[model samples]
Target: MSDKSKTQDEDLPYYDHPTGGWGSVKSLAKIIARSRPDPGIMQTLWRQNKPGGHMCTSCAWAKPDKPHTFEFCENGAKATAWDLTSHRCTPDFFAEHSVEALKSWSAHDLEMAGRLTHPMRYDADSDHYIETTWEEAFEGIAAELKQLDPKSVVFYTSGRAALETSYLWALFARLYGHNNLPDSSNMCHETTSVGLKKVIGSPVGTCKLEDFNECDMIMFFGQNTGSNSPRFLHTLQAAARRGCHIVTFNPVRERGLIGFANPQSPMQMLTSSRTKISEHYLQVKPGGDIAVLAGLCKRVLELEEEKNGGVLDKAFIEEHTTGFEAFAQSMQQTSWADIEQASGLKRTDLEIIAGMYANAKKTIGIYGMGLTQHVHGFVNLAMYVNLLLMKGHIGRFGAGISPVRGHSNVQGQRTVGISEKPELVPLDKLAEMFDFEPPRDEGRTTVEVVRGVLDGSVKAFLSLGGNFARAIPDQGQADPAWKDLTLNVQIATKLNRSHLLVGRKTWLLPCLVRSEEDMQATGPQAVSMEDSLSNIYGSVGKRKPAGEHVKSEMAIVAGLAKATLKPNPKVKWDDWLGDYSLVRDLIEETYPDDFKDFNARMFEPGGFYRGNPARERQWKTESGKAEFTAPKVLTALGELPGEGQYTMITLRSNDQFNTTVYGYTDRLRGLEGSRYIVLINPKEMADAGLSEGQMVTLESAVDDGVERRVADLKVTAYDLPDGCVATYYPEANPLVPLEYHDQESKTPAYKGVPVRIVA
Candidate 1:
């Protein structure tokens, strides 16, 4: 590590100070300095928050027609302010700096310079990036792509890309004979889709925001609602006020879950009167979620047998589900002693939760990456469904499952077909809609793509938005693998860490921001997004374009497609680029039943809701019922590190999103301006003969060889369960091996890793 890296590590303590005002001021300064946008420009952009403009790109929960006076959140303001930055990367700037020099700069510093003004090409001999014309850049990319095998090319999509852009990219990849779509979904919620599909026959949740108000009891498992999804705080507050019982189960006592002041409410904000959130909080050990869920279900089953003539939904199970007998037998086989030990919760606690469930007429379960980023993440989701099935929570007005997605358009991308292994039906339908036979072979996922690049199977990487290298685990392996790629193209509005990990030939193409107006040959364009509730809504940008030269993502994809693909009389790339509604029309044709009147419905204020099978208690399985799947118990359950070692979980701070670091401040943890401190129980600290704020190193107990040791980290005593510790993500992601992912979902096991603490 360099002196700068060492200094940053050493400054962790200062960042963790609990002084709120100073921290907020420091964060504001950081945001302004790092974004490097003119204050005047940002003020002008901020004024564009009119009635007809779309909601901020960071969060999709904003209500339309609401006054712009209270429209933005802290993160949303930062995102928009950053977009309005006046900095620009001219050809002279690139010519002055070598790729090696730029690579040395921090991720934030590179992006602070502003957006790419024109197309650029990497010069290998000079190790610098020089400006190039759009025609030359397209021609070079097309010539190289035509020589390589279609399978060798990887098309990566980020969450920031608009729906129209995503569809065009998918269309181009399919028309060019490739299905290699390694997207943002692969890193986040692939587990939710994979697990839900097997049991509910749909990859989406059935619950809407309205369901939160109607539920009698709400159980939040393995999710940090306050930090991961702040908008959920409003729902939680409303439910609490309505006398609904709310329970939170996680390793950390998240502040947002405890209570929150509605920033939008003038009275609440001015008076500082906060609404209490959780009635009960259970801090369970990391990776112990499966045991906790199973225990609750077991207790519910026992209660059902005693009072409700067996707690199982006999009618629903028999009529719509399969494999009940096997699943019940497995539950019967699980001993209470094992469950108590693994979950670190008493038997009475389980009964209390179960009693609440049994008495409630309806309940809604909400989860985030915490539950899905585990080794048995898919199984964890299945267990959640199993609990719902036992009580017949599906097909009801107030009861269902909701998985809070991270990005605005992530679900939209999946809806428009950005999958590595797209189903045959969709491929066949696309072939009929576009007059081209889509590739039937399976493509590479995120991890698989990295591995392919390492082994020389993949040649190119075309990313639409995210910083993949930083977001993915196993950076030690990925950094070298990234250098081996033949071409790396990023279509983004700003710079990020992934841009530094350049390939043999790299290109950075500037694109319009989501909040910016997208004008093409056709006219003004409108994009669509699918929310967590499976509701598809139209988003129209009313703000002017950030830069005159910047193009919408759709136009960029179209240009690339026209340049690379073999000439086909049937496909009209230019026509689709001219009008995005035509792309929606094609999407409607491909998925006729779901997207009828694609253009007409989108004109409605809130857009349309997609089909959800669980809402009607309809299971699309072969047996016309939901299926019960019992996971096999691994023999490694009882095993632990020799001594003085416990499981470690990675989490996000209240001030930051995935890789986009707005600032280093975690107000909920009482840690301000810091991203590198470990939270440990005071008892655990004393048991290890350590004091608060003692420097310690964490060593991975797993044999995956991924290790991260931070010296002199402030050990703030927290109310976490025994044998469990917590730290922030990306910083702690290095401790998780790429192979330590859920088998069924292929999502990284970020929440659970065995580790030892040392001085």
Candidate 2:
């Protein structure tokens, strides 16, 4: 390996701050230098984050009404500068380097190489990618797809695409007679959509930024808000200053949950003083979230019995809910002993939390992957809603459940048909508009798609963005399946590992990023993006294109649709690609209730809210009320480490977002210069006869008979729950088994993985 690639903890220095501070500014400078952008690039950044301009392609945390001089965050700068980077991966670059040579580099090193500049086709004979014309690439994919069964074709989307592109993606898939759709959301928060739909009759969240301003209590369970969504720090800091009590539960005591030094405020930076965030931090063990929540629900019921005055919302429960008695009985039968053993927390700890929730008039609950990436992920979500329903936390401001969504527009992708199972209501609307019978079969998810590929049931695969080979679980199985596909195609901005893993015939279509201008027949056009809060607005690129050959994602999608699907007068691909307004008109017809006058609403200052009716106490269930479904079991963590085993949960480093690794330094956790590492409890390390900084291998404890091991990962002692360990995801993804998933949502159990340290 090269000297730069041989990273260890010995040479690099680590820094710690209360979330955002001067450290972020210094880190931002380092990223800009790495991008090697022109001095005039500042002008592009200045105009890129405006209302009518392209939205910041980083985190989906909603921007404030009152914009700052520099509106973007530290990570946002990295994402934009990454696109504006002068480094280009032309055809010559690929020709000079073999596929095997690139495989030796780290994910961060590969991404830092630069943006792709032209369409390319993989040549198996030479083991290198060669330049190809757009027509040749399109025809190659069309011929192969037309020869295969439409059911064998799988379509996947990342959270990065604009609404214009996503709308066309859904339309084209139905026109081509297939519904095997899967997106990034299936990996992240499918539980929130599925679980919330069962409980509240809606898959969307009810709380807004205004809720944090008015809520008496904010319970942050399993969320590292400061690191994942830094823009949320502004609202969190404001609430802390206004005397709102914050409670947090997680395996790690994240610095963001403890305190904050607002980098956005010059005064806060000058003082170098930090403001405390969570008043109480409960360190719950991994896979033990359900027990803690269940214990709290039982305590609330006890408090209601003793107080007898106004503990439970009796009127609201009677008027707007069902199945309460059944839920209450389940909570009662769940003993404190079982709760303590399962949750790894004492009854007193849960009682303290229960009392806090009971006293608060208004409460907002927020959670993340800690709860969603478990085998009982769906039940974990239901338990939270059950607790909230006991106190009537929904259908009002300052009180509701928020699953803390991860990508910039992941929720938006689902809002506009990037789904495997499109709702019947939307299907009827699409059938009426296009004069085509929508596919009635239940679609496939990410896991299902991978299984199809492995069994030879699936023949072709197409991706808009995201590196599926690295992002999904069971790399040992998924990677080879991708290589053996009949055809593989990717429409992407940068070169990822997935692009290098070629099938019989693979094509990489270069597309313009959010920072580059999208010129079309209808002149300069602006696309739309939806935030986690369901706010939709226009985003137009400001700067010149990095490559003359690169096309917009919308154009690429339309072109592929025209090439594959036979001509139909109702489906006008060229018109939609040329004028994006025509696409918005189609979306308006698809969801009239939500996107009414979408073309006219695009002109709104920051876009429309696309409000959720559940927020207004209108639960459109079979009974026209919120129905509670209690889990039969209180906790899903059956047992702790067996002999020399540990329950592992995959995590993201501070310097990265999703699968994109910007650097090896994770400032929040105080590690640097390596992604191949594991964090273990010091006590557990001593018991396992392991020492800090020891190079070791991890073998899965699951007896699937598939030897899944991650070797050469250095061990580091950390302050985590005993018998529990953590490692950065996409690196440890191989250790996760495809069979280990939430039964209800099919989300892989990334947090509940069972493994043993190998000598």
| Candidate with best lDDT | 2
lDDT of 2 by residue, 106-194 (tens): 88888888888999999999999899999998888899989988889988888888888988898888878788878888898887788
> Tens digits of per-residue lDDT for model 1 on 171-205?
88888878998787787788987888879888878
Q: Tell me the lDDT of model 1 at 27.
A: 55
TM-score of 2: 0.96
Q: How many clashing residue pairs are found in candidate 2?
A: 0
What lDDT would candidate 1 get against the real structure?
0.74
lDDT of each: 0.74, 0.83
